[model samples]
Target: MNLVTPPEHPFAQFVRILGKGKRGARNLSREEARDAMGMLLDGKVEESQLGAFLMLLRHKEESAEEMAGFTEAVRARLQTPAIAVDLDWPSYAGKKRHLPWFLLAAKALANSGVRILLHGGGAHTAGRLYSEQLLETLDIRLCRDWQQVEKALDQQQLAFIPLGDWMPPLQHMIDLRNILGLRSPIHSLARILNPLNARCGLQSIFHPGYQAVHREASQLLGDTAVVIKGEGGEIEINPDASSHLYGTANGVNWDEEWPALAAMRHVKPASLIPEHLLACWRGEASDAYGQLAIISTMALALRGLGEPRDTAINRAEALWASRHQVART
Candidate 1:
């Protein structure tokens, strides 16, 4: 009997294509990226290949085409329910310096009748407060599956799906942070994965160049999205600093600069208390920084929904003022 050697693994081509050399390496085309990500998500790739592929992409700083393709692959694998969702909120970047005030903004929007879908990779990074851990405290439903997501949306107008529940492989990649010593491209791709096909996608990026990449990728996917350099990399605007908004509207891309909410910078809290979110909502506490963050974040969402800048600010303020009535209803 003669022994025969197997051919190269199909996934190896992608890794090779990316790792060829500094001059030879190039970003994957949309189709190739889709195929590569599909293999990764399906667990068809080898363990070594997964690490190599991720780090290669990380080194190259994934292009808009690559991100759009990765997002396409993830969305294809998603079992999204037929729910009317107005916004797709991806909160993978956990908050460290500030409390996740964006959660309150999202809740208020849901209360005002905007159906939203929020998703995140759980608390993979230590010393950070993830939305997954605080959803229950905020009274937002954390759904485990499509059925639960549908029900939550029908009842609460908002639902949060943890990445582990929808796509375990991506969550696993995020969890490899400590071992890898650097975050993989999953963090970037997850933000653009609007699995539910919502009308608007809100994404936050902390790194300097990623905002444009996210904005362009969403445009490539024909998604109306808003990208902001939010507080602590979560999708909450800092009241003390001006925010630049990169977004797509009606197939056209646009950029805008939002003035800071406060005339002067305010000191950050020494520690974050989750209950403050609930207390503020219940009118039991008043925090200027937190309140401005919520209102400004809501304004960004409203702008993504086609409201003019000034109108969005005004509407956000009105919504914040009337939140108690909306919460009761």
Candidate 2:
């Protein structure tokens, strides 16, 4: 008997049945994961079936092999641009609470000659505008075409691609999350997919629970990446001085000495986060904290900015300090 055979109906039919709770909650084999992802990415899966598939996968939780297989299917569908930069940052959902700092990080990296590609979609909620909106606030427009992105990278060392253009199917999956009012497996997958040929990426996750999922996903990637626990899901290092875990292609590194809030002698309360400071950072007005956050995250990135840890940190501090003079001017 041939053990390997396609399902009797369309793959979407099988997906709909599997998603409808017909199949007991169980881990998907590697092949099953690949086929499901392929159908979703190709737009062959119906909206209802899509929701079911996503929810089921979330409950079952993706294993490393399953994630790798699913990502491989996603990678196959994405039109990755050939850029020379080694690092790309893919920001995830939710950024309403804290000041958006990834823009500053991207700008600083661009200013320092690191080719950075940033990508994300618009606000799923009324209160939360996304990184793309924040970038627009800074006069940075999203580049929809691969050639245009390459041109921007060659000229300014930075480019932003909107999800609707860079990966529509993935965006479609993300849209479903909003409708369901629950995050799906695509949320995790989106954070890990690097759409550039570059071999290194910087990814940030907001929830601690997802850290292991990111780690497992990163192993499927051919390039080196650092997974950071970020503020409001943006990749900027936490300004509250929380311990951050940095997972690279080789292994994981933890910052043990990160200052805790209670230990700090002088710290601003979350209620006291200055609006003028945020506006200035957002370019709606001029303020200092935004500038400080930008400088600090840039320094952090520079410390591990593709060099030996010590050298990167030393250089990052020096570079950060140098910006203070400009802030005065």
Candidate 3:
């Protein structure tokens, strides 16, 4: 296969370079990865070729430089809304067993004067579903257009952008992973991709193994991101008082169980599933999980946005109390 021919277009060139690889995995140089990603975001690569490139990248695994380069390429294609605060939260893409709290976290942060943007979908084959479904239950509509996303932030200080709506090609790449019956490199890359020039970000991680990757990538990217090993990959700390909750920014770090704040008590766990939780929100049924999700997520959001430990605990208690009364009535 010829790797040096200049095709008629950048995308075609990308297809030629990436398609030259065999069916199995292959390591990619930083330049190759960047060129391929640039072609992808520029709409230069054909759909089939793009799918092949993604699969190849998955089997090979992405290095920090490659991931960073790919992220830059993707961001160039994004139409970011002009919000007062450049806040971002990347959902880790798999959360079926436990309840989702990121939606609640976004809402609570928005309520407390923080500008927030959340991105995710509902096509997890193994997991129960994504966070998009939970937001729908809260009456928060997904913004389809980048302009509308900006407008939502300008007007309401909160916006949710489904990957399908914001970037179809990238979503197509993610969908291809489903064909393999497991997650692909895109899954990990998506968690670290911050499209907007957001100075503050709340990033969630699923497995502990990815902590070094996230930390290294965040450091290299030099963004102010708080990495959380939240519940089921959502940005909520475990309420058992046993799990260690950590947040890091600019080399400074803090945890919920630090010696300075060891007096905090664990919140009670919720017992309902995602669908039933929504029903409970609508007053059509009772959902312990929904209520717990709201409380725990709100607390974590407060902490993520720089709220003092005591204040976060107090705010969570107050919000839970208010919601409980409403549910009773």
Candidate 4:
């Protein structure tokens, strides 16, 4: 007869560090958080302790140290091949009000020879249409693995990988939303992971208050990024609303506000159709609102990638005007 020995709970100590009440509980230092997250990604922690540890981090806001450490651990677990990427665009936010205008912008940039790596997850929240849902409509395939991501980029300069494929533990953590009835820290960590360590990263928040925290955390990760209070918390700029962009530009911190390109219009469209994005890209759709949204978002991305503001704007406009998706095909 053989007896099964229980696995040691390696994460219990870190959980205790954060779970103790006011006097005893303290935030994990970068190193401690790194160790804990490493254990999490390595499958070293038990399920019960994992839930407790996640909630504890969520209860008290995640610090810059924690975010940095967690991301560092994630990168360590990934065996990413050497892939040159011009931009890291992450989209986990689902859009209820509008089609993803940013998708068009990303493709347009790719059309202009920019290599973009778009990664995201879906349905952390129920009832909203996420980015992955629009792939078929856009004629872009969802990369099932890292090799596919590289191949897609090589063939078209644009590729999208879901978070579930990029990192399974993160996907599992994000899935806990349905279980815990609240978002765990992975939601924040997923957004900030520029897996390729790209030169430019794009992020946004729904709540205006988290703007500062996201900005500072991006800085802490030592990855160049641009953060904004984007439409429905996505990186798509609302052409009708002024967008304040916060991040490191040219290795220097920047806080710049881009004024609205059009007047406020509160009327929601009758439908949210993904095909319109394809139409807009192919010059078959004449939506003033949609076009402005795409151009402004592309301009923001170019700026984050080190283009001067004026040059970014001019190039973005030119890229928009010269779009020939239909003509090329």
lDDT of each: 0.90, 0.64, 0.64, 0.84
The per-candidate count of clashes, in order, stands at: 0, 3, 2, 0
* Model 4 accuracy (lDDT, Cα): 0.84
Q: Which lDDT tens digits does candidate 1 get at residues 129-230?
A: 999889879889989898999898888889999989989999999988788889999998888888888999999999999999999999998999999998
**Model 4 bad stretches (over 4 Å):** 1-8, 249-251, 325-329
Off by over 4 Å in 1: 1-6, 327-329
Question: What TM-score, computed on C-alpha atoms, does each candidate reach?
Answer: 0.96, 0.80, 0.74, 0.92
**In model 3, which range of ten residues has the least summed lDDT?**
320-329
The count of backbone overlaps in candidate 4 is: 0
User: Regarding lDDT, does 2 or 3 come out ahead?
Assistant: 2
Ranking by lDDT: 1, 4, 2, 3
Q: Which candidate tops lDDT?
A: 1
Per-residue lDDT tens digits of candidate 3, residues 1-329?
86886657555554454446576334455566667787777677677666666665555556767776777777777776555565777764656555665565466556555677777754665545576666667755578877877777766667878887877777767787667655767777777776676666666677765655565666666766666666677666555434445556676655555221224444434443666655554457754545555666666666666777678878875764544232210
User: Model 1 — which ten-residue stretch has the worst lDDT?
Assistant: 320-329
Which candidate, 1 or 4, would have the higher TM-score against the true structure? 1
Taking all chains together, the TM-score of candidate 3 against the true structure is 0.74
Please provide, for model 2 over 15-46, each residue's C-alpha lDDT reduced to its tens digit, 9 standing for 90 to 100.
54445564554566667778878887887766
Ranking of all candidate structures by their TM-score, best first: 1, 4, 2, 3
Residue-pair clashes, model 1: 0
Looking at model 4, residue 273 earns an lDDT score of 78
Model 3: per-residue Cα lDDT at residue 298: 69
List the lowest-lDDT window of 10 residues for candidate 4: 320-329
